[model samples]
Target: MAAERGRPRLARDTIVGWMVLVLFVSLLSVVIVVRESLHVSVTERANADVTQEIEEFRTFTRTGVDPETSRPFTTAERLLTVYLSRQRPGSGEVIVGYVGESGVVTTSYGAGAPDVDEYDLTRDPAVLRAAEQGTSGTLDTPAGEMRWARTVVDVRGGDDAMLLVAVFTGEGTAEADRTVRMLTLVSLGTLLLAGVISWLVAGRILRPVRQVQEAAAEITEHDLTRRITVGDDDVSGLAATFNRMLDRLEEAFRAEQRFVDDAGHELRTPITVIRGHLELMDDDPASREVTMRIVTQELDRMSRIVTDLLALAKADRPDFVRLGEEVDLPALTISLEAKVSALADRSWRLAHVAEGTARLDTQRVTQAVLQLAHNAVQHTADGDAITLSSDVVVDPDLGPALTISVADTGPGVPVAEREHIFERFAHGEPPDGRRHSGAGLGLSIVRAIAEGHGGRVDVGGTPGEGAVFTLVLPTHTPASHDHPEQT
Candidate 1:
């Protein structure tokens, strides 16, 4: 297929070539028209000069007398001499006559023989043709073509004879030929100028395009920050779009880097614990059993950390959550209370429920709330109270919101960690001396789910008082006309 197709043309070169071709053709056309006009003017002048010379010769031959000398010519021979010497034609003109048996070459101009008798009239096709025609016409002669005319006159010596008057146009044609040569040169020069202009203009317009190519070439995995400079034209607009794409790629790269670092760090501790316990195992059944139990527990912790990281990673995907679910807030709140009751002996109660429904990922919302309930249980006493609530609120700037909060009577987060408590690997130290094996991924998971629904998570409480973790999610898409009426 590749061989079957012809080679591609470069845009700049093609355009320039076309421009030059058009210029050459146009100028050549002008040159032809101008050259033809010059030839016509030259021919007209030559024919006129020859015609007037013939008329003058005829008048003297018939009258047989010179207007200046005012005397009758006795014979054809005398008439010929008077016409040649007395009324000779201008430069580049020729005159010849034949009276009875005598022939004479009266005048000659330009190069070649001055005597006309040197060449026989009968053998010369030009002179013979002119004599046969009996009128003025162009003919090929020794001095090139002549615009000649001929007439027969009765000679006093005896019989009638021929007279000729002609002008050589070869010399007259020189000026027209020079004009045509100059025109041809001018046409070629015009074509060159046109090609140069086309090439320069194409380069100027494609400058930004070249910049985009260079910028794209410079981009790499480690350095996605390269950007192309924009200009004022449409090609510059394309460069702007190219820069924006690079920005998005750079952001995605940084995000992936952070994800890898966080995942590696979180999995390190459990892996170390598992390795240490397995290495220190003894041959005795009791020691082996204890090691197995410790290793198994660490494995469970590691599994949970991996699960949380996977969830966070998928949160950025398009189908990460079931966004089409129409969740019933009252029913969701009731189910959450019943579910969290199994976590601990804490008093799990439903504090509030919004009357209406919301559009969101129901399963994800439940998972987030469940994570918060577990966190609260981990920090609170066995008998402490925990309240789960779901209510929708309307704000001028934020629109309608589905706010679900979990409040517990536990060791609340300290004032210092409030801002970053929702960050991955950010957690409050357990109040009790006994340590809890949480991956510090619960709140971050909760925040991810909330933000996935175009919302956020916030905490509210004093340092000593029980803290309330609120998951405030926007239930409605900003431009949603999918559900015209409130659900």
Candidate 2:
């Protein structure tokens, strides 16, 4: 069930859907605010125009009085009644009324106007203020309510009569309402169109990301050579970096495979020798002696191979153990010269001496030196001169290094074969025409030990001349002892 659910989905579509949702919400909020503001502005302008017309009419009544009879041409109620009756049009109405100082016995105009008792002019603060100040007052009137605006004008006569102008103010509100409804419809349509366009644009932008994800999903250890194809643009650089990472992984994988194969091959020979000796032991007592000796030899070889393999593996580890102690190169060379002299038939010389010192793993360093000495001896004639020398050299690139060289009067290594000579299982014919007995891991093991100590081995020779093998290690101060203990 989990595997089935892990199947890849359309990532581009998902991104586009979320983008469109956010855009729709943002655009909708802006449209709502704009529509509301436009409606309010339109209603305010319409109310101002209506109020101005009322003021003009009031001014006419105030100034147009008869000078001879000392009376206005028409009464406030009669003139307002005729004016408002003519002003009534479709979807709107107008009315006129009067309120005296005592707030009673008022006159009204227009047939559709509500009764004066029902219209609470005194209860409304704005209307009451307008009546008291003899000015105009405008109030917001919602639909389904008896709403209006009133203008109070005082007459210019001694009778203290007043003119009151009132209009239903719903016309401007209705027109604004209609405009808002139309704008809302148009905004919703725009939002829909914008959502569709945003989805398409989002899909276009996200398509490359989806393609990269798909290509990544198809990659595996067995098929890491495959790469994502991209255009020669910014996206292509990303692909190139990804491909480089894959290349490193592939190289690491191949190295691991080679290690396994080499290890198996190295172990097989010793196991076969042991098995053959054991199988022959059950047949005869005379053959058992030879078989036992053969078994012992094979066991020794196996021990050497196992030890070398462990050392190589430890060198590769990040936290490989290190035991540092001061060691004298001249003294160590003297000990090795003595041991090699006792073990071989040839004469060994110690020359070009330097009293240099180093902090090193004494036992491992001695083993590496012994291996190089043995290798030189194996390639030399029985009577050839073997020399072990020490010198302290300061190289411009490498700083101070204690150089220990073993030179033998043997056939030298060829130039083409020099690079591969340090690799495992690399053996060539010596000057004496005798080959070494073991798998060619001696030089490889020596190189590993040198590298473990943060040093290196250098080889130089000419054809038919002797080869000089030098082990270079960083120099240090000598310890105040006869000989340091092995690490």
Candidate 2: regions farther than 4 A off: 1-14, 43-148, 158-224, 227-249, 274-286, 310-371, 381-406, 446-457, 471-487
Question: Stretches of candidate 1 above 4 Å error?
Answer: 1-194, 429-436, 479-487
Best by TM-score: 1
Q: Where does the lowest 10-residue lDDT sum fall in candidate 2?
A: 477-486
Q: Which pairs clash in the backbone of model 2?
A: none
lDDT of 1 at 96: 72
Model 1, position 343, has a per-residue lDDT of 88
- Candidate topping lDDT: 1
Q: Estimate each model's TM-score.
A: 0.64, 0.61
Candidate 2, overall lDDT? 0.64
lDDT by residue (136-219, candidate 1, tens digit) is 777766656567777777765555656776677666677788989998997788778878888898777766666666676677
